[model samples]
Target: MKIIASTLLCLALAAPAHAAAIAQLKQFVSSTKTLSASFSQTVSSKGKQETASGVMELQRPGKLRWAYSKPFEQLIVGDGNTLWIYDKELAQITKRKQAGALGSSPAALLAGSNAIERDYLLREMGKQGDVEWLAASPKKADNTFESIKMGFSNNQLVEMELGDSFGNQTRIRFSDIKKNPALPAANFSFTPPKGVDLVSE
Candidate 1:
């Protein structure tokens, strides 16, 4: 759970080669104002792997909800201003400023209002079958991720791989993605559960 939690921020990196890949990525970013998808996530480290499945919803300019239901239950919400992480089994909720939590993370690239080109250097990593790949590295020096690779098929984002300096990798596959969906404001809002410990940062 901690691996997933920590790598959530790493879910955002790239270089250039195929002009088509970059174009497709830019198109997806520019056209996708809101999105919803079912995701399967894998985190790998030192020959071990952990997997989880969940649904995600997000609106551009900073708002997202990630609800995990497999292996355990956890919720991560970014309500424009604040980021909240709720661990159901432990009965604890952790919070921090949204901007501070995201920085140049992949979540920022996906849900943030900022121009992606300004914060990341995009590179084309060629194609893997039908999926065109692009890589990104944060322009910021203090970013947590070492790099990020995204795969797009038919100009739609379908996969993401994130790497960190510690040799850990997280891979996420999105399916049944609905672009420009009308997401409810409630999805992005959070209220700490009664009797749960609240840790604010």
Candidate 2:
């Protein structure tokens, strides 16, 4: 699960750095209860880049599903209590308590409570093309990423870029976003398949 873990942890660590962009983020978070979107992600390091595509769904106060159907298959789910990471190719599943798995990270920004200001420091990055940008870093030390930036258009999250401690960068763009969608509870639940290895932490 190295690939999947690194991909998600790096992206999760990014936060807005600019204060001007907070308005869009605040409004979006305040109004949005559930969201679904198709996303494309790219990770670049030392002149090499890898790309992946996936679909994601999340409901506020903790619940999410990230389904990767690209070069390989992986599924990450948070059922508001436990977090599950399933790698289909390896037939392995990793599970952890949701509180320890997510905390106040970007996952919380999307699906957790609306207390972002307590965990992240937001700064103004002005605009990048058509998207208004915000940059963020955690108040507490996070070795995974040095900084993270988010792009918003018309108060909707459309892009995110993350830079890691090793100078690696990951960018994700969301398309066909549907806000406040009716996501069923089962979408966030997970169960290891028969004979699959399970690691509980």
Candidate 3:
């Protein structure tokens, strides 16, 4: 689960890119204020495969809610200043400062707090079928993923691939994406449920 969060944060940081691709990414980021999507995630590592399905919601200026519904129930929410991870079966909630949790991570891009041009080297991978692909590598040495590739269809993000140093790959496919949806304030706010042990780090 932690690895999953880290992978997402890594997506927020990207390096430089070609002129047209850069312009497209910039426009996509700027014009998008709120996004909601249903996603299917596949993680392949060491000849094994695991999959999960979830719904995600994101608001600009550092707010997101990720709820996992299949195989298990878990929630990860970031509300600008804090991040909360709640495990339903374990009945535990782990809380961390958002700054320490997201520092230099590409997740900041989703929050509208980080600029892609400043953090990642972006390259146009050209088109694959109906999707236009862009590859981004982090400028920092401490990044977790080896590289990140994003696929956009008609200016809508539909796929992402994250490769780690250990040859593990996580691919996420998005469907039913609603761009600039009117997400309520409560979606990003979380309070630990009763009987749950709250751990702060």
Greater TM-score among 2 and 3 belongs to 2
Which candidate ranks first by TM-score, i.e. highest? Answer: 1
Model 1, which residues run further than 4 Å from truth?
Answer: 9-19
Worst 10 residues of 1 by lDDT: 9-18
Error of 1 at 35 (Å): 0.2
What clash count goes with each model?
Answer: 13, 12, 14
* Per-candidate RMSD, Å: 3.5, 4.0, 3.9
Instruction: Give per-residue lDDT, candidate 3, residue 113.
Output: 58
lDDT of 2 by residue, 129-187 (tens): 87788887878785356777888865567888887777878888888888777989889
Please identify which of the two predictions, 1 or 3, would achieve the higher TM-score against the true structure: 1
Candidate 3 residues 42-103, lDDT tens each?
A: 88888888888788888887888888787788888999999999988788899999877865
lDDT tens string, model 1, 1-201? 254455452121122333366786676666677888888889998999999888888888798888888878999999999999998988999999989988888888878865989999999988889988889999988898898898877656778899877888989988877878788889999999799999999
- What would the TM-scores of all predictions be? 0.92, 0.89, 0.87
Candidate 3: regions farther than 4 A off = 1-4, 9-21, 165-167
Q: For model 3, what is the C-alpha lDDT against the true structure?
A: 0.74
